[model samples]
Target: MDTSASSSQVAAAAVAVAMALLVPILSAAAGGDGWEDAHATFYGDETGGETMQGACGYGDLFQQGYGLETTALSVALFNEGWSCGGCYELLCHDSTYCAPGGATVRVTATNLCPANYSKPNENWCNPPLRHFDLSKPMFLRLVTDFRAGIIPVTYRRVPCAKRGGIRFEMKGNQWWVGVLVFNVAGAGDVKAMAVKGSQDGQWADMSRNWGQIWNGDKRHVGQGLSFRVVASDGRALVLDDVVPPAWAFGQSFEASGQF
Candidate 1:
């Protein structure tokens, strides 16, 4: 398996969760819920295809399906210091699937992967979906090599209406992700932000703390980051389990970790 790609996928997954957190703040400012940004679909159950179950929002619907589809893929609280390397199967289009000895092959779909692409609708099941077991808890960042033509299908986010008091896992940390995104094309700035507090398993209250990562500059136009929870209450936060958020966006190049 391509460790770099797998790692990138893991990292990008975190940012996707983080990106979902930005949708509400952006939508509230825009005075409307922004679900028309692109033609995308979310899936819950996995048989190696991105199927739509006709649900609204992003990750929330997907998580619901996952719980019913596969126990390993279900949403739960990851304990601190849980470690194990496991393998799972998934289907993809155009991407090569190979595993080295002792390597865990995790076939997944990122916001940038084509296998997870789907038409925009209120369905919970759609195309371009993936299924697998999360081996560890860590915030992941993904950066695609667009130069190689591995472009993301489109930008996506979780609907704010669904993210109230819900938590998800990313970058090895558990967090209540907000569904939102930033528009750099018109605004010319997409700054990275973080949710504060140990309010695990709870929705983020916007009237709280936010840490800025970037300030919409030329460097971050086509790039993004996801900050995972590393330290909470002055101790390193251990991720034994995590729940996926209600929604999130996909990306090409991604990274994971806490700031």
Candidate 2:
């Protein structure tokens, strides 16, 4: 339903290769052998009102197909905002409100659970503390009681399992290009991005602007587009001619395959 991306930033994306093989190297596993301790709370109602927009730069969550299966990560797990789009599996733990032997919920990291310095000790999202601020629906799936407010939980990183191909939404103007990368699979978090225009056939390196958005300096109007995307684990995907020559800013494009 929607789109955006990252850098591997502050440096150039020097590993991009055009016409590379389709092979995707298995990502280095970030998931742990056992669950890690964490805490969770719910935000927004069942309609997911407040959960729609986020710090991840993602647009309408439902329109982007993220729906309610999304969460805001504590600063510790947010990886300085690069963790946007990463997937996590969570299970209720050691809480009376937990659903008995319930299946774990898998959610994407779509926002940041900011720490309140004024209430440092009371802030679960403070640095060095792993926490999840989940959508009300997602949190209720784990806890039997919505009134519990917060619940102890365990979680682990997991390969994202997105349906269909990865999506890209073009943002910004002709002077600069901002792309929002979403619906990613595999390592979920993008490490680097490069774009090419049919007219020039030259790749322009993009830097992590913020959240899941990447920015580049070149202008490629009225040209077919290709993309080079690298995941956090070093795997890469090359999408050739995914956007037509007539593509315009704000239009979303889907590549043929995923990483």
Top TM-score model: 2
TM-score of each: 0.17, 0.85
Evaluated at residue 72, the lDDT of candidate 1 is: 25
Predictions in order: lDDT: 0.24, 0.84
Error of 1 at 82 (Å): 30
Candidate 2 residue-wise lDDT at 209: 94
lDDT of 1 by residue, 1-259 (tens): 6899999999999999988986654443333553122121223223323332211112332442221221122111111101000112221122222111212122111112122125434221223232222211100111122122221111222211121222332211122323222111111111223332323332222211121111121221222223232222222222222222222323211122121
Off by over 4 Å in 1: 1-61, 64-110, 113-160, 173-191, 195-259
Candidate 1: what lDDT? 0.24
Clashing pairs in 2: 4-180, 4-181, 5-181, 5-212
